[model samples]
Target: MTETAAEATGTAAPGTTAEPRTTAELAPGVVIPLIGLGTWPMAGGEATGAVARAIANGYRHIDTAENYNNEEAVGEGIRRSGIDRGDLFLTTKFNRQWHGRTAVREAFGAATRRLGTEYLDLFLIHWPNPSQGRFVEAAEGLTRLAEEGLIRCWGVSNFKPAHLRELQAAGLEVPVNQVQIDPETQQPDQLAFHRGHGIVTAAYSPLGRNGSFLSAPVVTGPGAEYDRTPAQVVLRWQVQSGRVAIPKSADDRRQRENLDVFGFALTEAEMAGIDALDTGAPPRLDSDEFGH
Candidate 1:
């Protein structure tokens, strides 16, 4: 939760530029790093600086959304870092309010314009719209974007296993599915299904919003002998599972930590203990769409 938390993990800030290492290929053309930088609750100038610093310090993947209201800053950060648009993989989500055939195309266009990118690395349906029940319509817009070469890949956020089935049935391949996954609530069922069809899991709030992991004894407790925080452990779990974890931070140090998952490994025993904590924390972000 604090900016200083990441620095404690043994990574420092932008003294030199850092390059990204590819982990799992979300799709044939989309590769998401094991660790990605997240910019939510990182607003305005802070979000802007975080993006730039993340890139300068070696972060290649950034996760953002229209709901975050900071794409322009994210764009500025990309511009300032001078990292090639191709080398950096960026992701953003559409607002749930804009999820219909009537609005999907324009909303997608608006998001691209705001991010200042001609083609997005990935675009997600931010949340499910139950009332509309028009995932197919929205998927059509996404397919159009992909066909037009405006976005390389497309997916959804906060979708459950059943919802994933529905989207797949809609005839759109959901490449990257973003959700709030962490040590306390690792979505094995959801992740298994996603992997079964080659869909990538992009985790949001991977730190449990600093709520679940920090509360767990394994992370913030006497078990700290491993010299890693609950957040880092959860992040490590995400990486070990072949899921893309995006940890957010506005502070220089945490941003570095979010990007610093490459140098360590967790034992299978430790991973099992963490996996035991999965309690399926009651649809914190995307239940409405699941009903559709």
Candidate 2:
């Protein structure tokens, strides 16, 4: 793939030393980087190289999932990064097909087995297995893991406010909720609900799946004054909102650009402009339609 990083406004933020700044607390004293490297479809040697380069470029947070089919490569990248496991914050998710307590435990065991790790910094229920119709059953396993100190943090992905309400109704406390977030897909209602009640948000598809967000008005309007690419501006917007954005890219240059967000800060007006881009806050990846 080709590499490109251009601020639509011609004024890119100055590059800085490769150290991630602290952001929201996933739990007491557990602060996560505002940005994370994501491996969705990249796998095998490509996955390995992408992760290796990302970590070498100073990405401390990594986002993966069983569905990506690249945990082994992800593990290889982490090992090659030469950063101690303690220095890197690892994240992965459990697919909705495996939702029961017994199944959830089996799922985590297998994920660790593939990732070649003993534990993850954060683990998420990829989606609520509506098939079971009683999604709370999986929380039993999470509570046990928390009690045992196996996984440090736990949460859900692609979940709506209603889903969080469901987890709360069952008395399960999820610290982070990963969702598809970008200028074009902002989830303000979801963000408001989570932040108001002490839950953090992780943004996926922050770049609009490659070249899909270049024409958004927010990217071309006020974002132009910042001289940032539509993608970078969106990631910046997510960061300013205090949401962790995990933008995925196999292209090395773009992967590095995704981590370049800490360089600039978005003003309140810019943040609000991104917020206004939300189109009724549609769901990006609903649990009900997921497969494999």
Candidate 3:
């Protein structure tokens, strides 16, 4: 019932050539696949089965978080997938409630136990929790985890450029900045800042939350030209534009379809069309006043 990356490659859909998944090296020896399976709304058996299916479909990068409340299911899916842990990149985050040094250590241990992994490929601070004003202390905990080999690398999520600057001022090295980004909420400035500082931009909601963006002419128009679905077009735009997209789907067919994106390339014009679709609308959650 499970498939290896090689097996998945051999089963590429008709007319589509199988190319190796694209990746970005966040650090000297850390390379993360550009496309990953997001485990947010997925929970319980559904999350477990979806993760297993995603692995079978050739997704090596899996993203989950403490707040997702599905780490156990994500772990079960990995076990069922029958893939070597080393071949997969597993990521999880520390919850906002666990912000201080002691809490981060305890939380990281709990996540490892729940996920059944000896070491995490990457770990993240779920939010800046700027109100708490203890992110510096939390980053220190992540630093300790990295040094002890509990986590390979550590970063932050929902972090604005200002928050990142504050962390940097305190001498913390952030390798990735996960944020909600879609054609509707382009985030060009944030992306630019992350790039300038060598932080990988991991897009959480690469496909607009409501799927409203899919109906846009820019997205559907390219889907028609490339004979691809709107979802595929949007995902391709993310990968092509150089951000890691973690789109969630529980359907097995959709899982396979999502990973099949590497076979095609989007033209510069097509990319521009998607870029022009940004409405600059407000994001779903404003980190400035959000989080635990």
- Model 3 Cα displacement at 6 (Å)? 25
Lowest-sum lDDT 10-residue window in model 1: 1-10
Give the 10-residue window scoring lowest on summed lDDT in candidate 3: 1-10
Question: Who is ahead in lDDT, 1 or 2?
Answer: 2
Clashing pairs in 2: 7-228, 7-229
Q: Residues 185-268, candidate 2, lDDT per residue (tens digit)?
A: 676687788766777778887777545556767566645665666677777767766678888877878877777766666656
Residue 180 lDDT in model 1? Answer: 75
Q: Each model's C-alpha lDDT?
A: 0.72, 0.74, 0.84
TM-score of every model versus the real structure? 0.84, 0.86, 0.91
Query: Which candidate leads in TM-score?
Result: 3
Candidate 1 residue lDDT tens string, 92-188: 8887666776577788779889988887888888767756676667777887887778788788888777777787787767777788787667767
What local lDDT does model 1 show for residue 229? 59
In candidate 3, list every pair of residues with a backbone clash.
none
Best by lDDT: 3
Candidate 3 lDDT at 84 equals 99
Ordered from best to worst lDDT, the candidate numbers read 3, 2, 1
Candidates ranked by TM-score, best first? 3, 2, 1
Could you list the CA RMSD of all candidates, in the order they appear?
Answer: 7.0, 6.4, 5.4
Candidate 3 lDDT over 1-292, as tens digits, reads 1211212222134324456457767665777888899999999999999999999999999999999999999999999999999999999998777888878889888999999999999999988889889888898998898889888888889999999999999988688889999998988789889767777788898887788879988888878877889999998888777688899999988888887787776776777999998888767888878985
